[model samples]
Target chain A: DAGITQSPRHKVTETGTPVTLRCHQTENHRYMYWYRQDPGHGLRLIHYSYGVKDTDKGEVSDGYSVSRSKTEDFLLTLESATSSQTSVYFCAISDSYGTRGYNEQFFGPGTRLTVL
Target chain B: SQQGEEDPQALSIQEGENATMNCSYKTSINNLQWYRQNSGRGLVHLILIRSNEREKHSGRLRVTLDTSKKSSSLLITASRAADTASYFCAQPGTGTGNQFYFGTGTSLTVIP
Candidate 1:
């Protein structure tokens, strides 16, 4: 929450347009994640990166793509923005330990995207 | 699909009272975590209890995990108005996957 930040806190775009949301963390955590939140539904993971150039798709990765070219940055891109893609996006980072998957994730303030 | 579902979607209590919220998950998990989120804000990790551990506490926050039942509960003592927020429980689902599945969450209102 304190170390992670998402850029363009609010964005309004038209359908079929491309949009990119950026997640930056100063903590240098090893694991970065992208999620979307909607009404009646909690946060859902879209994509996650364990390290630079190592990314994987989450349960809901249909219209989203993620790239982590650097340690401090993870980007989520909407190839063709649609109204269904309009939701709040969150970036999270987790400090890795010897025991994998045991670390807690820290979240960003979130980016609110509107597709018109 | 959401791995957890929280009970009493919303709660209202007066100051200095105790508040409790329950979360039920679908599958076995290594651990369960509770988080709090204020309006228009990010989630703050509250507490995490492993499957082997039944209960844990952090100041006024107490968390209990019942692995046999695949459920967990978060308790807040001496609640204040500032505690009014949404609380969610998340657990890494049954898989090698790293993603943590979250519940719908419970909205807590501490009326002063």
Candidate 2:
């Protein structure tokens, strides 16, 4: 939990609703990522941000969106929640900017979202 | 298809024994990293081994990378009950290389 925090530790929402999860970090790392963990699927990257306002889709980016307006905060949003989206979400930050090599990533506790 | 996958989907061992997990990837990688997650918690970074380096050690953990085989292994010595957790291996994604693809993970249960 290297200075990383995810708001709304747990939430239960019905399908078709919009939900947002926030990830705040004190380290101001250059990289931020959103991931979802489900049994048998391990962790799948939902989205990632390299710098403020710069974001990219991941392996499971469909049906989800992300925003990074500031250096220390990254947000993941589900426009229309689906029961299939129910899973534990995690936020991670890394100091390394380049791909050649990366410092270890620090993760937040996580937010568990359940959609019915 | 470039995602890293861990072998031995589940492991059960007694305390004080050594536990080993292996990871195999489909493509080239600059490095490989191991992370552990306690039940209901976020992942915690364990160790990282660069492709150029054959092996690396940190505390009770030893990580070995085999670039030729596109695989990596994590060995934990003197396993403890506290070591019961899920272990995942991650590597840079194929396209941009900025994002990482993590494996499903190996569930380790260390019996005391």
> First chain of model 2: TM-score?
0.95
Question: Which residue ranges in model 1 land beyond 4 Å of their true spot?
Answer: A99-101, B93-97
Question: Residue B110 of candidate 2: its Cα lDDT?
Answer: 99
TM-score of each: 0.95, 0.95
Interface RMSD of 1: 1.6
Minimal lDDT window, size 10, model 1 chain A: A95-104
Clashing residue pairs in candidate 2 are none
Candidate 2 structure quality by residue, lDDT tens digits, A59-98: 8999999999999999999999999999999999888646
lDDT of 1 at A31: 84
Q: Can you list each candidate's DockQ?
A: 0.67, 0.68
Give the per-residue lDDT digits (tens) of candidate 1, residues B47-83: 8898889999999999999988888999999999999
lDDT of 1 at B36: 90
